[model samples]
Target: MAKGMMIVDGQRVNFDGEKNVLSVIRKAGIEMPTFCYYSDLSVYGACRMCVVEDEKTGKIDASCSMEPRDGMRISTNSARLLKHRRVILELLLASHNCNCTTCEKSGHCRLQELAQQFGVRRIRFPDTREHYEIDSSSPAVLRDPNKCILCGDCVRVCEEMQGMGILNFAYRGSNLQVMPAFDRKLAETKCVSCGQCAAVCTTGAITVKNQIGEAWRAIHDPSKRVVIQIAPAVRVAVGEAFGFPAGENVLDRLVTALKLMGVDEVYDTTFGADFTTIAESEEFLERLKNGGPFPMFTSCCPAWVKYLENENPKYLKNISTCKSPMEMVGAIFRDKYAAKDAVDGRTTYHIAIMPCTAKKMEAARPEFIHDGRPDVDLVLTTHEVIDMMQETGIQLGELELESPDLPFGLGSGAAVIYGTSGGVAEAVVRHCLPDKSKNALREISILGLRGDAPIKEASVTIGDTELKLAVVNGLANAKKLLKEIDEGKKFYHLIEVMTCQGGCVGGAGQPYGLKKSKEKRGDGLHLSDNAAMFKRAERNPVVAQMMAEYGEERCHELLHVSYTNK
Candidate 1:
């Protein structure tokens, strides 16, 4: 591929290291529609929606599969290309279930958007595809095969990004469908419930399970004391649905919206992250003193924790016993409300607004249950919360700014960065360092801990001990690092593994966004960190007070949890 000019729709465009004609055309400012083309995944060339006419050869082929050349001339939207794209969309719509009025992904679906863009008013062909049963067996995701267009985005994302081939194409031709092996339910397979498949799905074929009805019911119940906690990543991304720019923090406006929607109390999940940071750092120190289980992997990500339980159980002991920030906070709220319940007779209905679908699964785990009730009664994704606001006829921009409830509302700067990749490692470093000065915090911030990289390594010396740390996002990258450690090719004292790329900011439950959007979200979290009054977890007076009130035994009981190999 040479750096030279090429003609795209009669305009000369320069191509330098662009892998495909689609990239070159996009670079030249053409919004070429694509269903099977994703920059982060391998080119499949299945949909043929990005086909372009080669002026010289008068032939049309998928631009996504063709390489950019020095003197290539192509027409992106010629009359013939338009016809082809329209027909392609029509054929897809013929087989797809067109019940958009009630579809979960009605407004945001790429298939619906493309069909409308191409003016597919009526499907030319009759619907001949058999209806398939919707699979809602999984706690985190739902599968509706009838809406599938065979784009294979979910299949590729699960296999390539997560290194989990739990989804794949089965059968052939008209009967073809994407599903787990032997047609098993997702919950029955070794699926970790990361929901990356749902993240990349073009239609409602795969989607995060909806809990909005249950959430609304809980809020309306007079006997229920509804409580909600918003995750750090959510504040940065939720504003995108309401016309705010990506990475803009709208926590105050969101608080107002939730309050208007009858939420009794609202808090920040970062307060829980603060507790996790302090407790995890203490656990790391204990491991260092014992001189064993060298690499203590972080356990805040339920997807990563489930991956280890499913795929590699031998190393379970190496994982930190500390519960995730969401769980820790849920447990605390449960305890606080249970005491209040004894007097007022109002049951606590705890809800978590998170950026990850796996949080749904995490909340349902038996380990987090006390007596017969789960700590977190419900888990809603960022998208779900947005839907709730919209359903309530509430406009976020119109709401007056409001603050979260006291006690669990405030969090340290270190806890705020837990939304992005390497943030957990950086927060732990901030805790381990004896120096709490501004200079120390600045140096820690620049220790290659912030980026879109899949894996980041750093070394720090704290109190006569040198610690090597690795922060890994994407389960595939984590798997690669684990293999290296197994082969004696690498070593580390602490490893922070986030299942989704770019950490929780790129979680499957977030608004559909690619690499750049995730970067913006990460930047927003760092900005929040810089604006915080307290930098370290230890400096949070509320957390310190809670620690003293709970004592060592109660803290261990609430904040720590052990995982099994199953």
Candidate 2:
């Protein structure tokens, strides 16, 4: 062992002034178990699963919150520590309802994995935990307190990251539980249903509502023609759910899988994003000229839309009137395809494969409903789509690749970047530029808008129009930016706000626990964009042809929708 290195289990590891022993051990390839220790959040040392012993001091402390010292000999798995962890698992298991087969997070639960890691045969502690009824009132998220491990992951994420305190510790002592104010139903509270709580949940305590059964029913129905639109982020994230690593673009395989699953028609939501870019860019240009609003906010993110509607209704008019890509595509499906395919609009079912749980709520929005049927009949998250593929025995890795159906299939590269935070603004700038200007396209590509930064701002001139653009992800960042706008400290002609961290790539419905998955997914989208034939939305032949066939005014009427302050 070296003099400056710390020894753990007879292995000398480099110490790089890591704030906690857990990080040092992890850096040395040691897997320490933890429930309450999130890398981005404040450490609370509640679980004590990572407790390590100092051989010299004869003391055990939580490795997550404990600072590492040079030449410290820490035993990560002493006999006493093993016994302590086993008992802790037993206590957690005793309180938790052991209905693993039907649980939404059965295979993915961290607590279950830890229990298996500790090799627990049975629980010694009696089941004294109080049971609570499951709350399925929210269209996007479901809450089952019986499965909660009291990790406070949901609580911290909601407050610290989102700036929305929808979930918190309620009651006192033994009766303590997580709930909205006054223990109100999640649907009744100020919950925007961003599903970050569900994303951070280690168990099925919170999860996106499963709509796979509805999709199956729609497909099985003889009268209904089931059509699906796949979102941009899903292509990158869905592969990870299977055997493939993160950021693998399996769009062609996904299309093949959908065809095998009896999906009647497959379309790309990026086609609709092309429509959005055209309409939203025109609207922004008009607003900029007429001074409709200083900063016209992008309305592609449904969760961000809901947040503005609920928390800041004053800016509702400032949001773009363009419907989200999914909804816009649904409108096109219902209006054009029904007559073309000789099927009644009532019998045609539209399903959206999205990377967001909030899209479920957005699909169910009253504004999107017409003739007593929703524009999108069902919303399947990336997780649910993977489950569907597995259930149907479709081998995604081995399947022969297939292209999406025509008309709404080929999307421009501008549409491809919509999955990340700064992507929307960059896409808009690209669309605004003329196709012959290769210099403008190159400039747009490197315009310092795309990154993991919470907020990014850039000023660029496209086609004689000097545009001020701001791109923001995470509602907390959006809130701060909005405050700056209110104070007149920040000024912009256009702003793109995504509710999640890295836009749709970091969506709540993505697969859990993939390191740097969002960045990889974003990179995948960029790679896909580089390979694409069309770079600008204005140059997309299908969208341009559609606009020519059906006048832009009529297309706006059909594809665009309104917002409400509910």
Candidate 3:
């Protein structure tokens, strides 16, 4: 597309390769209100909040669906456009469940924000919509049909971005609603519990299930020892709820807040990520020696694991048996605390604070439970932890920095970067390489592993052979790659697949953000990696000591797991 000029609200705006007028208008510094206009998704044009009027002819249309051309003139904030937006809001509110104060997405809901911005003080129509029962069948996500505005954001994200058409519009005309086929519960379908639907939902219609109450009860129990592990991505993204910059690392402050809130001990999940990197690298090397299962897929992401079990079970043997970092640490803590319980007479309640909603589902997997007790007692999202901090009257920004607990808290730089896409592959490469010098680490970092691209491919020479590697984020991209691999069009020695775009940094349970914010979060992880004392997982002394203490057989029993097809 050629560069063009247009007038948005009387200001001349230049557009170069912008897809829609809304992009050009936003580029012109105009804040256009929208409900269903997501940059990464297809244009629905269902919500007329971004309607603009043509200056030459008194006609109005959605800016998202219209392409910008040379010599185009439009009024974005005319009285007519405002009235149109207000009317649309009013109609939406008429049927919507308006209990904003009790909603999970209260302060962050787009519908509530736009309602106040457009002065939608009242609804003119009757609430004739039927009250639907809330669906809490999924362990990760909650669905409330009453609060839906029929924006189709969730539908498109699940289909286009995730390659999972678990959600779609049903019925006709005024009775249309988004739901699974035949209105099946999310868990009953092939839903991977990624929570991408909840992430894109503009209202409280869909949300992460609240586990804050469960977390609080465990914290308040004097008979229990509450130990929490914060995932690598949580540190960078959790601060967003408390007015911190998008990519700011608030781990130290978060550690202080968790301790102040009565947590017995807080550790970094990266410590476990180090173990994963080492174990996975060993597994890859063994497979390379055997010369079979050509590409061993990573098993860190629960959503990706579930997708394989549900949709592509034939390739289950190719997935590495290494437990996820969360589960690996949880199992170690469970064993550690079981001994402490025998001596101290206090039950240990292990909690995992993670950026992925699927972690909640992952924790509840049957394999992670032993003797009727779960390894991780509870799983909380980044948002839930922020909410808990706010409820306890602890402001993250106001809190002073404090170090994480020793031993299990210290993680290598390779482990810290596990929060983003390709970080796992890069970390494993760092472990595989014989050279441990800074230059070798720098060379490994530039292996096309770090970026916002959905799928990244690279190669590295190890010993006598060059190993082909691929890192993919987003299930849709992974699905495409899988198809190519199945057709013999693509081959790799090792593959890393993260179900969410940009890896856990762009997880649905993190602060609701698009591509740019996710990039900032990824950058924060890299910065932390750059400042670490050790660049490779194999260099982490704590991990090395733990491996020695646990021994080979015990380590294999605890750190590895096999999945059953659902």
- The sequence of per-residue lDDT tens digits that candidate 2 reaches over residues 364-477 is 888888888888989999999888888988879999989999978989888988988788888888877655577777877778899879889889875677888889988888
Report the CA-based lDDT of candidate 1 relative to the real structure.
0.93
Whole-model Cα lDDT of every candidate shown, in order? 0.93, 0.88, 0.93
Candidate 1, residues 41-83: lDDT per residue as tens digits?
Answer: 9999999999999999999999999998888999999999999
Total colliding residue pairs, candidate 1: 0
User: Where in model 3 is the C-alpha error above 4 Å?
Assistant: none
Residue 358, candidate 2: C-alpha displacement in angstroms: 0.4
In each prediction, how many residue pairs overlap at the backbone (N, C-alpha, C within less than 3 A)? Answer: 0, 0, 0
How does each model score on TM-score?
A: 0.99, 0.96, 0.99
Model 2 earns a TM-score of: 0.96
